[model samples]
Target: MPAEKISSLDDPRVYKFTLQKDKELARDQEIIVDSPKVVLRMMDAGRTPKAILANQKFLDDHGQRFEGMDCQVYWADVPLLEKIVGHRLHHGVIALAERPESLKLSALGHRLLVLNGVNKAENVGTIVRTCDALGVDSLLVDERTLSPFIRRAIRVSMGSIFRIKVRTSADLFSDLQTLRTSGYQVLGTGIAPDTHRFDKIDFAKKCALIIGSEGFGMDSALVGLCDAVIKIPMRDHVDSLNASVAAGILLQRLGAI
Candidate 1:
């Protein structure tokens, strides 16, 4: 069905779809995509939008993208749309898309990323984008990791989240141990006595690269469980790199295989 044009900001449908105050309200069932570029990417990735809110101008210019899409496109003035969404609608567009199914560790490839305590949404999104660009097989995040589906994370990733295979683990440590037993050399990003130089890692075998949180590095328990702790050679007394930056470097190197 074509989008039902709506002019009122108070429409119950608009209220239900534009749950800005509670970003995670229906996260399990639906995701909100702001900006036309992201929305278009979502559609191109075969994701169907449940509803779309945009100004008539936006519809006039970009509605063709949703030409045959079976979804409602609510039209409102720019000001009204802004008022309803609690922020300036990027390009006067926002979409409600059904969330994709979670991936399984058993279904992923040999090269995978394991995120331990990384909780920053932007970092998570950046890492996802990096993983996509570097050709990392999949992402395995622990319970404490932020959801990449969050609006800010999605925006930061520039729509790459939809392209990556992401799986969540209830017990990250146990999963890492399991990966070790599965022939994956679980390598944690850290500085330890046995920490190998980043460039020296052998990418021939299957491996899981572990990235930890920003404030605190990997917990000792996780560091201890690693087949090896890898470190990027730095100078000028730099102690560490941003989690996302470190992941990008590691992904680029390890994913080369």
Candidate 2:
């Protein structure tokens, strides 16, 4: 399609489409991907783009990527694009892409991450990127966990979210038990009386590492049912670590990557 020109940021369709809430993205099946790498990654993952909004420089440099795609390409001068997105552009590229369909728990792989109450999108994004890099098979998100498809999450993940299977479990407790029945050793990450050092755990078995929110940590009931609790031995006065950072350390040790 020929490139189109966006004349105004106040265009109703632009606001309606761009201002979607994180939760709405899954229902609407649409996402806004920023940066050239993330946009190109989304296309490579076989997700279709609804449209692409870029500055003239990007259009001139990379516009050929969209040559035969069934989507609109809108290019504007720098200032105009900044006005529309309400911020300085990131690598002068933004794309409106369709969200991938969610997978079921049965469809997820052997090694998994079951996020319990991990609500920060940025942290979730970092974890997703780590999982993709470390070869953690899939992600099973609880109801309270943030959606990995949000703009900030997708950007931070660098499109790694699209590379892994993601399934949302409506009931966190029940799903954890179900996984145990399915031959997965459910391990929760935390500091407790019974917490085992990272290397002490046998990672050779099928495992599902459960990560909790930064502030409150995992719920007591969920922690009690874990086959074993794992912790990273940190020095100094640090009692805890960021959810994503802790996940990366654990994944590196357990992921065998």
Best-fitting candidate, scored by TM-score: 2
lDDT of each: 0.81, 0.83
Give a tens-digit lDDT track for model 2, residues 1-102: 989887887765455235546556666788888998998888888886898888887888888888998988887778878878778886898888777767
Best lDDT goes to which candidate?
A: 2
Per-prediction TM-score: 0.92, 0.93
Give Cα distance to truth, residue 56, candidate 1, Å. Answer: 2.1
lDDT at 201, model 2: 74
Q: Show how many residue pairs clash in every candidate, following the order shown.
A: 2, 0
Model 1 CA lDDT for position 87 = 78
* Candidate 1 C-alpha lDDT tens digits along 129-160: 89888888688888888877877788788888
Alpha-carbon RMSD, candidate 1: 1.9
**Residue runs of model 1 more than 4 Å from their true location after superposition:** 21-23, 26-28
